[model samples]
Structures are given as C-alpha cells and as structure tokens.
Target: MMATGGRRRSSESDELELGSSGESEEEMEDSSEDDQENEAEIQRLEEQLSISAYDYNCHVDLIKLLRQEGELEKLRSARQKMSELFPLTEELWLDWLKDEIRMAEKASDRENVYELFEKAIKDYICPEIWLEYAQYSIGGIGQQGGIEKARGIFDRALTAVGLHMTKGVAIWEAFREFENAILGTLQPSAGSILTPEQQEMVNAQLDRIHKLFKRQLGVPLLDMETTYAEYEEWADEPDEFVTQVYKKAQQQMEKRKPYEENLLAADPPKLAEYQAYIDFEVKDGDPARIQIIFERALSENCLVPDLWARLTLYLDRQLKIKDLVVSAHERAVRNCPWIVGLWKRYLLALERHQAEHKIIIETFEKALNAGFIQATDYVELWQAFLDYLRRRVNFSQDSSQELEELRSAFSRGVDYLKQDIEQRFGESGDPSCTILQNWARIEARLCKNIQKARELWDRIMTKGNATYANMWLEYYNLERAHGDPQHCRKALHRAVQCTTDYPEHVCDMLLAFERLEGSLEDWDLAVEKTETRLNRVNQQRTKAAEKEALLTKQEEEKNVQRKKGRSEKKAAKRAQKQALPGDKRKADQEEWGAQIDQPNKKPRAGELEEAEEEDMSAECGLFGRENNTRILETPALQKQKAAAAARNKVLHDNSKDDLTVFVSNLSYSIANPEERLKEVFESFGHITDIRPVYSNRGLFRGYCYVEFQEEKAAADALRLDRQELEGRPMFVSPCVDKAKNPEFKVLLLESVMIILFF
Candidate 1:
C-alpha cells in the first residue's frame, strides 16, 4: 500500500510537473522503500532506548533533562556524581562546587569545607566566593601550627574577610585566633628541645601571640611594661612591689609546676608568697584557705610576725588551741619585737588557752625575756593579771594567796613600765584621756583596800591637774562597791563639785547618788530639774496656742461683720432696684449681680494687724503646761526614773556573797555499822562506844547508842555530828543510860529503848 501510494503520489507529482516539469517511476519506488525502512528503524531505536537504559546513566540524563526543567534536587544529585568523578570539570565542577557549598553550609560543615573553597577562591579570584570562604573560617584554627603560623593564618583570614570588613565578624575571628594561640594548637612533646633559631622563632611567635592577645583584649601590649622584668632586678630589696613580684612568681611556679618538681625545686621566697596569699585569702573571708596558706608559710621558714598574728587569729576564731599555735605566735614576736599585733594576739591566745594562770604568767615572762613585751604591753599585762585575780575571787575558796601573788606581779610589771608610766601620767594630753581613765578604773579594781583607793583618788584630785575628772568619777564606783551608802553619796557629791564642765557626768553622779543610797529625795530633785525644762517648753507652747486661739476668734468676728455688711449692701441694692423702670431695673439688677459674683480681695492692713495681735494673744494663752505634752511625758519619765532608782537601790543593797557549801561524803554503813561508827569516832579523836538498838529476835532498830569520854566530849561529838552528817539531822540533848538500871541487860537494852520509843 505504501509502494502503490508512493507511485500514485509520484504519478500525481509527475502530472503536476508535466504542467511544469518531468519525473521517473524507478526513482519514486526507490524513495518509497527508503522511507519505509527509516520508519521501521525509528521504531526499533525507540524500543532499544527504553530497554537499554542503566540506572546511573539514566539518572544523569534525567538530571540533565530536569536541569533544563529547573529541577534543583535532580541537578544537585547529578552534580554529586560529577563531583565524585570529574571534580575539576569547570561546568560540572562549578555546579558541583556550588551544590557542595550549599550542602556544606546546610550541614554546618562549612569550617571543614572552607579549605577547599579557599583554594577555589584563590585560583578563581572570585571576591564573592572568597568572602564566603572567609565567613566560614571563624573560630577555625590550623591544627599543625604555632602562634606565628596561627597569626599568619589570622592575617590572611582577616584580609579576605576584610573585603567586607564588618566589625562584628572581625571581632569574632580575632578572638578565635587569640584563644587558639593561648590554648595551643597541638599537644607538647615530652623532653623536646629546640635549636636556638627555633627558640628565636618561638619567642617571636610568642611576642606576636601576646600582641594579638592584647589587641583582642583591647589592652595595649606596649603599655604593659613587663612588670616582672622591672621588679626582678630589685627582687632582693624587701619593698612591697618587689615582694609582690616574688609572691606572683611563686604562685605561677606552683600553678604551673608539677607537685614532685615543686618539692625538688630550690626555695623561691615561698614564705613571702604564701603570706601574700594568706593576706589575700583572709581579706576574702576564707579562713581555712588562709590556714592552708599560713601552714605553708610557717613550713617554709617560720612565719613572719604579721603572718603569725593572722594565723593565730585564724586559730583563735576556729577555737583550735594547740601548743604549736602558741609557739608559732611567741616565736613570731621574739623574732620581731616591733610586731605589736603579734604581742597582743600572743597574750589573747594565752587567755583563750585553758592552761593554768601560772603557766600564762610564765608565757608573759617568756615574752618579756624575748623583748617583745614592751612597756605598753607590760601595762596591759598588769591589767590582765589584775583582772584574772579579781575574777578568781569567789566565796568557794579564799583566792587571797593567788590574788596577793598576782598583785605582786602587777606591781612589778608597773614598775617595769614605770618610766613610760610616769611620762604617760605627766603628759596630761587630751588624747590620753581614755587610757588614763582606764588605768584609774584598773587601779580602783586592783586595790585590796577601799581606803587605799580613796587615798589614791584623793592624791589624784589634789596633785594631779584638773584634767583628771574622769578618774574622780571612776573612784565613785569603789564607794558604790563597798556597799557604804553614805560614802557613795559623799563621793558623788564631791565628784559633781569637782567639775562643772561635765554636766553629763554630774547628771550621772546625781543619778548614781539617787540609785545607791535609795534617796527618793535626790530622785525627786532630778525629776524637778526635768520638770523645769518641760515647764519652760510648755509655757512657750501655751503662749503660742493662746495667740492662735485669739487669732481664730478675731477671724470669726471679722467673718460675722463681713456677712452683716453684705446683707446691708444687698438690701440697699434691692431698694434702689425696686424704684427703677423695667429696662432700667434690669440694668441695675445686672450691675448688682456682677458686683455679687466678684471675688473678695485680701484683707486690709488694719485688719491684718488686728489678726496678728489676736494671734499673739491666743498663742500667749496657749503657753505653759496646757499646750505641751512633754510636760506630761516628763512627769512620766520622772516616775519611771524614781521607780528604777528605787529598784536599783534595792537590788544593789540585796546583792551579796552567795552561800556555798562543798559537800563530801564522810562515811556510809549498813551492817556491822556500830563497829564502823566506833572507827569513825576514833578517827575524829574522841572516846565513844556505839551500840545498835534493835527489837528482840535479832532484828535491828534504827537508832544507835553513843557514849563519850566526858560531858564536853559528848557535846563536842554532837556538834561535829550536826556539821558532818548528811540528812541525819540530830538534836544533841543529854540522856541517861537506861541499860545501866538494875534489871536491864545489854541485849535487852534495844528492846527497852524500842518499847519506850526514845
């Protein structure tokens, strides 16, 4: 059918050509066969294409087709193959590169991929690509690099990113390089030594590293001045700054050095360094840390005086009293006599340490021998001795022997400080007031005799200048302690008379007089003084209230007068308006209304003067106790003061030595007790026989028989019994021996006594 159609078409074309040209049959048939073969081959090729496609190759073709269709996912997958195979292909490579860049960014593997892109950028000179490469290099460090190498990498990175030169990104990259340099790029090799040139390289690298670090920190490196180098030359001097460097270098050695090596190294001002740490730690409120520091300090030579004082303070606060701590402080003071704090702390530590007083006295003696106890400390030591003696005085036992010894020591100590003592007493300077007054109080307390205290104070009052008024007041306390009411009163009165400059002291003395003697009259006098002050205040207040009342009353009268005048004016206006015509009356009414609505002006000068006078009068009437609550408050305070004085007097008079009895069990018996009683009686140096009184049948009675050598002996034994027996209270009256009667046997005596019940 194709040959026939082609022949017919050929005939038709030949006929059309006969109208224009000519054609042949064989050529038309040949053309027809060729067309049939082409159609069949096209069909076979289409079938082969469907049957022969490989998955990867088909994917590549599909990708190309999808790329032309703008399918990015397919294009990306195909680009991945090309990247794995022909990675340097500029078309496939750029596509692969861009896609890889995108993938690297999406996975946050940009830092890992940055090197590859950086190479690409250097080769291509693509500013946009280079910027992307630099952006991804933030916080990235070369793994196999030193500080110099790191600095070069940072400079290159900065130059690349500097094309954009945003401050925020530059800051981040600089910090990253700085941190990398400090932390180091690689682990250090053990026992590794470098050549001199390598060392020089290292030093140059370190300098660059330090400069970069400083730049990142915003601190100028040139300005640092190598504080250590400057002070190292002056290290032998004991100045604060040299000592500070010594301290810091020691710390660095400790922090960076291994423990074993640290132990083996030569001593490097370790004591001074630990002391610095101790001072710092103490200021930071770390007592235990300070303790560790102090321990280290003392371990490396003995601790310095200042360090010893702080260490003892730490121990004292912790309540750890050790012989070692005591020895440390004492040694500190001995080594440095000028360390006053150490001296004080040594004494204080002794006070806290529960050793005997004799031992403490020995400690002070040791301090004196060491030349650390100065004259001032000697005075303090005396006061401590006196206080110890006073506190030891008790009703339990007579501490008189100890007190006398203490007093002797105190006197010796004062004599030791005598030169300073005399100079101090003669100074009479205002600054010496507190010290002198304290000394006076100590003197009063230490005096065994009230008469001595009184005599000493009298001498102070007579020869010692008028500057010693406080000393006089302290002496008043001695009379109070004596429980002599009249003496207390006289002392207070004399103290008040001695000085008028001290009103508070006078008032205090007055108050004390009232309290000590139970003198309600003095209390009333004190109240009267307070009441006088209150009354003066009340009188002034009353005058003010009276003046205010008068002013208010005058203001009320003026208000009434104003209302009356307004009423008269309104009546006059009404009368005037009542006589006018309609329009004229309206006009008059408007005028009157305008006048009525007008605001009242301020009062005239005459009225103001009158108001002022009324105010003065009211305030005058308001003066005195009627206007002031302080008048009432003052009376209440007086009542309280009186009650307090009376109570204090009662308490003061009632205060006395407490009753104390030290009880010890003498003897206890249950069976064969009469023999034990005889033994007891014999031990007491007396002639006495004891017989057990009991009922018949060998049962014992609760009473016993006692016979003494004589009547005086019997009475003496009874007296001793009353004093020694526990809960065996007895009535010591003489009685006849009933067993001595005619019919009474010794064995029946118990029955007789039991039957008689006596």
Candidate 2:
C-alpha cells in the first residue's frame, strides 16, 4: 500500500511537472488575456446581434469566438443558427467540422462527426471533405461490420466527387488504396496457401482495384496521364481495355488543352478568357468542374459584380441550392456595394428564397444607404422595395399591419423625394407623381377610402401637377368610380378651373360627365359655364390674331415700297445711258448762252438748213458724209423740230418749278448709285427717277439728278442738303439753271452782306 501511494504521488508530481514545463507564467498570462479578449469579442458580437439579428458579419464573429473558446455546445448552437439563416462557406464548414471531429471520443461522438461530414458534402461536393470522411471511416475497420461500412463510404465518396477534374484524383486514389489494403488482408500468409473462400475474396478485391484504375484512367481529370502511367506500372499485366480508355480520355484532354492554355497565358482580370472557359464547362454539364472554374475566375475578378451575378443566377436556376445561391448574392452585393441593381436583385432573390421578414427589411434599409449615382436610381430602388411590400399585403384586409406599413412607406417615400431628392438633385425625381397616384389608387380601390384618395390627389395638385388636364381627369375618374356623384361633379368643376394647358378637353369632360349624371338644373349650369368660358377664350384669341395681322401688314407694305424704289432706280439708270450726247451738249450751250445774256442768233432759212445738214453729217461719220448728198427739209420735218423745241421748253419750266434736284459730291465708286440714292431720298417723298451721271467709260461721275413726281417732294428732299452719303457731304440744289435765276444770285449777295455786318 505504501508502494502504491508512492506511485500515485510520483504520477501527480509528473503531471505538475508536465504542466509547468508546457507553459511559463508569462505564457499562461497571455493565454488568460486571450481568453478574456475572446469573451469580450463574444459579448460585443452578441450585443450587435441583439441590435440587428440580420447582421451577417456579427453572426460570423460570434461563431468564431465561441469556437475559439472551446464552448462546444454554444459553438454548435451558433453554427446551427447561422446555417439556418445563411449558407456556410467552404472554409467555415471546414473549421466547424474540424472542431467537431477533434472533440469526438466515443462511438456516438463519431456518429455525430459522420452526420457533420454528410452535411458538409451536401453543401458542396468538396473532394477534401469526402477524402477525410473516407479515411476517418477506414480507421474504424476493426469493429463489427466496419470493413463493409468503410468500403461503402469509399464507394459513396467516389460517386460523389468522381467527376471533380482538379481534386477528384485524390478520392479515386484513396478508394483504390482502401481496396488494395483489403486485398492484402485477404491474401494468405507468406508460405501458406489460401482457402477457396479467401482466394475468391482476394481475387474480388484485386478486381476492385483494377476497376478503379480503369475508371480513373477514362476520366479527363487533371494529371490523368500520370494516373494512367502509374496504373500501367502497378498492374501485373496491363489490360487492353485500360489502354483504350486512356486513349479516349487523352483525346478529350487534347480538346480541353487550349482553354487551359489560354487561362494560363492570360493576364490578371482575364474575364473574357474565363467566360469562354465557363461556357465550355457549363456545356460539359459537370457541376463540380463548373463550380471550380467559377471559383478560379472569381479569385482574379472579385470586383466584377456581373461575374458574381452570373454565377448566382446559374446557381439559383440550375443547382437551386439555397445556401450557394444566397451566398453568391451576398458576396455580389458586398463586392459592389454602390450598385443599386445588385442590391435590388439581392432583395428579389431574398424574397424568392423566402427569407425572414426582418432580414428583408434590414436589407432594404442597407440598400437605401448605398448612395446611388442618380435620383432616378433611388426612385427605382424604392419602387422595387415597395413592390415587394405590396406583394406581402392582402388587399382584403382593410386595417392590417402590412397595410398600415405600406401606407407609411408611401408617405415616407413622397416626403423623401420632395425634401431629400429634390434638395440634392435640384428637381423632383418623381416627375410623373407615380407614388402618390399609386397611393391614391390603393386607397380608392383596396381600402375603400375615398377621403384619403382625395387628400392624396390634393397633395399631388399642390406639388404643381394641377396644370395638367390628364391629372384633373384622373382625379375626376377616380371620384366617379369610387365616390358619390356630388364629388365627381365637384372634381370636374375644379378641373375646368385649374386646367390651363388643356381647358377645352376638361370642359368637354365636364359636359360629358354632366350628361351622364345630372339634373336639368345641373345641365343648364354646365352649359352656361362652358359657353361663358368658351366665349372668353375666343375673344382673347381674336385680339391676339388682330394684333398679329396688323404687324404682318406693316411689314408687307415696307417690303413693297422697297422693291418699287429699286425698280425705278434701275429704269432711270438705263434711260440715262441711252440719252444722246448731242442733247447733253445742247443743254450746256443753252445754259452758257443764258448766263452771258446774249440774244439768240437767228440765222436765215438757208443758213439754218445748211447748219442742220453739217450737224447730221458729223453724227453719221466723217468719210461717209463727204460722199452722201444732202436733202432739203420738207414741211413735216420743220413741224417736228418746232414740236421738239416746244417739249424742251416745257421740261425746262418743270425743272425750274422744283420738281427735280441736282445732287453732287457723291461717291465715284458707288455701285448701282441710282438704286442706293433712291433708298436714301425715297424716305422723303415719291421719287420718279434717279439719274446718276457717268463717264463715257461707264463709270460714275460723282453727280446725279433726282426727279420727283411732285414739286413738294423735291422741296422736302432739299431738307437733306449737306447730309453725308458714303462718307462725303452731298450737295442738293434745285435743277433750275442758275443763269436764269437772277433772284437766287441777289439772295446770295444779301446773305454775304448780312455775314459781313455781323
């Protein structure tokens, strides 16, 4: 008994010594501090979860904290809760399973580990987990029925992950290794012979190994060529069937080589190449390979939300795996937090997956805080959320919580757009007033609350929508459909008054409404109001038309006058050019003779006839006149000359009467001077002609004659004397011969005398 006591003491001393050697006091203190930190983290996570049960990050943190604290019960509960709420990621499952498996000590405990392994495999066909499961089952082969149980697990794992191109080889090799071990156990001892039953078992096990090698060789897995070569070396006699399978797989591998080569040669963010590869894998229809390719692409293109969206859509539609689809959606929104479409799609996906009500609300709140790039984006997002809420409400229930919540959201949305969106964007995003219209519609149709509908319409109008005839008509129709006839009449009356853009349409609508449901008195009042308003509108339109016509008539008159002046000026220039030079010379000689006060030389008849002949000869041609015979004037010729002289005297008398003005000092380079001068002087009075003097060479001579149709017009034009024309002062004087006007000379002398006296 003393010896037994000493042994117990020695064992206790060794335990203390082991504890002391394993951890110093500083290490122990650090460990205690770590435990305190973990506990504090747990408390913080729990507090956050209480505040927001939908906080996914907080749930994750709490799970990690409990697992680190080795609180198995709490950790299991946390994981279970999280699994129910969210799909666990591959890494999270691995961590949880590892912790669970390490804590198992009994057969029942091992059974729990098996259940976890099953759960993990269902979440994703992960080859590593299947291999671990197979190997774990192999360790229990010594118990009753353990060998067959282990064999069954290996077979199940092979079927589950057999098509994984990159990681599948591990499971295939593990299965074969288990079968080979069984084959060794069935073999007789070194020098002994095996019984018939044992011999048959060994042959069956060997056949299993051969079948596994042949199956693996046929698959187009990564490093499959190495597996084929290894099988050739391991098999006692290589099977022709195995060789044929390897060749077929090689052909497939060749077909896939280019895609793999492209992936390797691409630079970072190889989205195009990955998309091509993904399409190929999808067509191949191996979910495991498709998933692997997606993961490979996302590692390089994590920020590409479209890639995430595509993967999520595929998982949702094809796989229909709730956890995977939800996880992809969550990651997609997290990667592109500011994309409103991503958040909107996430909300829809949540609803489709039947997420908790509080979780959907929290997600919507987070979406609102996502800071969209435009006011319209906010409206669309709000519409999506409202659509979800609308789907949740049962219209039959008049006063349910959902109905109240829907009404509250409508009110908040309107105020938010008016106060927040307008303030930031400088214009209301809800230009169509869709939210208010929807609210009014809901109140009218579903709630049977016409008063609330009326209030909403009033608010819509006060927001500057009253001018629209359609808006008023909408209100009228709503009242007609849901309210009493009196309210409909009131709505139409207000519409007629407030509708400015399309008053006639509103008036017609009021008349139609009255015709449908009105007394004789109402019909009379409607007709009177419609006629009075129409008459007022017609009068205003007529006044505007008269003013416009007056302006147009004035403009047309100005254009006509301008065109007439131009035509007259052109005619005068053509006439001036065609006038004979002899006429000009004769006028100059007459003026010179009058200035000298010489009596006209009246030659004898014979001398007059001879002088006329000489003038005609000079005009015809010098050489031709010498050979031509002269003819004596007849009685008709003498009469025609007397008539011309009489007409010339009449023209001279009209010139003296101030019917023409002589303008000089004009621009020599003036183009179309006759027309330009008409434009300037026609403003005074009616001008008959403007004759600009030109040189024999067809150039302007800086002087012109302006003849008026009336003497008063010439007098009025004299007021513009000495006015600047083309940067030179123009001189205007009566076309009267100065030598014939003795009174004008006497007046000039008197003006000189007055200036001298002053």
What does candidate 2's lDDT look like per residue over 93-125, in tens digits?
Answer: 889888877878999998999888877765455
Residues 109-199 of candidate 1: C-alpha lDDT, one tens digit per residue? 6554655564453322233444344444443434443434445545654443322211223433444456445545332467877778767
Error of 1 at 536 (Å): 24
- Counting clashing residue pairs in each candidate, in order, gives 22, 0
Model 1 vs truth, CA RMSD: 47.2
Where model 1 places Cα greater than 4 Å from the true spot, the runs are 1-276, 279-292, 295-304, 319-321, 351-359, 369-375, 388-395, 419-449, 459-469, 503-508, 511-758
Worst 10 residues of 2 by lDDT: 1-10
The whole-model lDDT of each prediction reads 0.47, 0.76
